[model samples]
Target: LQVGCPGFGYAEDMPSALQNAARTSYARKLVDEATQATIEEWQKQNGKLALHKAVEDDKWKRDATKVGLLIDAERDALTRTDVGFRLPVHLAARGHASVEVVALLLEFYPDGAEEKTWHGYLPVHLAARGQASEEVVALLLECFPEGAKAMCKDGNLPIHLAAMYEASAEVVALLYEACPDAMAKLDAGQAEYVEKKRKQGAAGAQAARESVRALLDKLEARETRDRRIEPETLPQTEEETSETVAEAA
Candidate 1:
């Protein structure tokens, strides 16, 4: 696994030698003999390829330019999953990577949002878990709205995971907005999973969960109000009222 991987947070202190290996690979096209030699040197130096490091670097730094350069220089790494249970896009979204980096990965692999990790968390799920910016969540939703409703292997919906794991109210709000119906449709496992999170007493957990609950209340109230509005209950103009009276008469 990459040392400064997303979940581990070690990428910030990644080895200088590793960074140099990647820089050497990035300076030339993959097909060049010098590039291959450099790659061989990198392998002997670190036993991993520069492309993977570049992808990981993009995730940690949120640099779309580096990501684009790496992708252009190492297209095969586009779909390659790192040893650390993530694709390049997964790492990007999970690391709260910039929207440009996230968008670039999506453009290259539109289905990445749905690609599940070994733990059954997709990119969107990780984005929520990572407390990613609202824009990142929206970008994932734009590509795969169904991902908003995706369940982890353990049976927790994305919103449930977000409310429980993520502390950002905005991130929770974005997930809630994406799947309002899920809020009302929780089964036993879902409720239990969330209740456990609420009990954790983590900083921002209570507020984030409550914010989702408040939104659900508002949505439910709106739904009830809409359901109660029959044609007869709707406001009538004076002429319509008079017509109704005349018909009754």
Candidate 2:
């Protein structure tokens, strides 16, 4: 006759009452049947609970601050590139109140220190393209003494870009103030070419010369106006002055 305990012997050799109680306890621990309804209720509220937790932890505030700083840094760096030079130009053109940024760049990187091209355009080219306000244009011209004559690849001058875009009279006038010699050079070259064509009896040569003369007239008028308007010097703001000093260090 065999007598068995739960761990010491097989179930077939165990007392029936002890085996039944062991199985009942194992099932209760494994299944947890009492909490099934409560678990369903918690699942329904999970999304709202997660949102409240995130808010309490200030996760959104931290994320926004980080993202905003990153965007501002990226924009600042892009504004410093020569090829992406359009960025600051457009900013100044629109009078975005970021004139200080433009002033800082022009003052610090007059000839575009790290630019790759042989005739890498100075900041003046960008100002011309954007048709910046007279104040902005004058500020750039001050930094680049010969701002109007600054050339790019293939000898394209600032005036050429400005004329192509049909910028305001004020922009053209500003260029004349900075570099009258450049305008005169272009005009003289055009006139001589037109005269040669006329002497050769080229067809439509007279008409072409008339058009050239008209452009010269406009250029001369702008130069006159530019002389009449006093040039104002723009001082670098405090923030820009500090940044420039730090860069020098």
Candidate 3:
């Protein structure tokens, strides 16, 4: 009803840019919906929000229902990263999230698996380093099948990181399956990494290396057995067949 009020400008005086902004509800909605726990606030600080705090406070409780609700409420935080280091996916995979948590995160933000930390560690790398359960690692791998092959800045693959922690034999095996070439370098570099951690008095370092060694030995033996059976499964070459017949005679 107020035509050209003193503070309001005339129609000709309003620029298109200003007109668009004036028509928008930015300020009103922002003020109405303002909260301390906004996704922007959390991401700018440490990539964590109430959901992450709640998960941690609950001590890794695997309440899928509650976590699902949290995700729904804060869907925008799914891909949020720390100021410069880790992403929520990294934290989730590093033994802090249950299989359900991993699955749910991937279902919503599958690309998070490809995100790396400042140290060039993928979520799979963190999962391996944390000695997370096979199920969690499996979920990460399912989302980013090539993550196992990703090498950190230090040239450490997921298997290399897994070898540093005990009870990660299965995770190591899974990474090996994804990138068999990674194993060829395991003996030389992996042992060194484990030894360094052991000297630092890291808990279970020796035991972890032993577990990795056991898995490697099993893999080697299996490879040897398969090689011995390969000739029988393949069609014999002419020279090999003649040699075999002469040997039999």
**Candidates' C-alpha lDDT:** 0.60, 0.41, 0.58
Better of 1 and 3 by lDDT: 1
Which TM-score value belongs to model 3? Answer: 0.55
Q: What TM-score against the true fold does each predicted structure earn?
A: 0.55, 0.37, 0.55
User: Which clashing pairs does model 1 show?
Assistant: 4-10, 4-11
lDDT of 1 by residue, 188-247 (tens): 765555445434533353354444344334433533443343465456899998998999
Which regions in candidate 2 have their CA more than 4 angstroms from the true location? 1-97, 106-119, 187-249
* Winning candidate number (lDDT): 1
lDDT of candidate 2?
A: 0.41
The order of the candidates by lDDT, greatest first, is: 1, 3, 2
lDDT of 3 by residue, 196-243 (tens): 433453333334334434443443353343234333555678999999
lDDT of 1: 0.60
The backbone clash count of each candidate, in order, is 2, 0, 0
- Give the worst 10-residue stretch by lDDT in candidate 3: 1-10
**Model 2: per-residue Cα lDDT over 13-110, one tens digit each:** 33244433443344345434544333334335543232112111323212322222222223243234223343333333333223333333332223
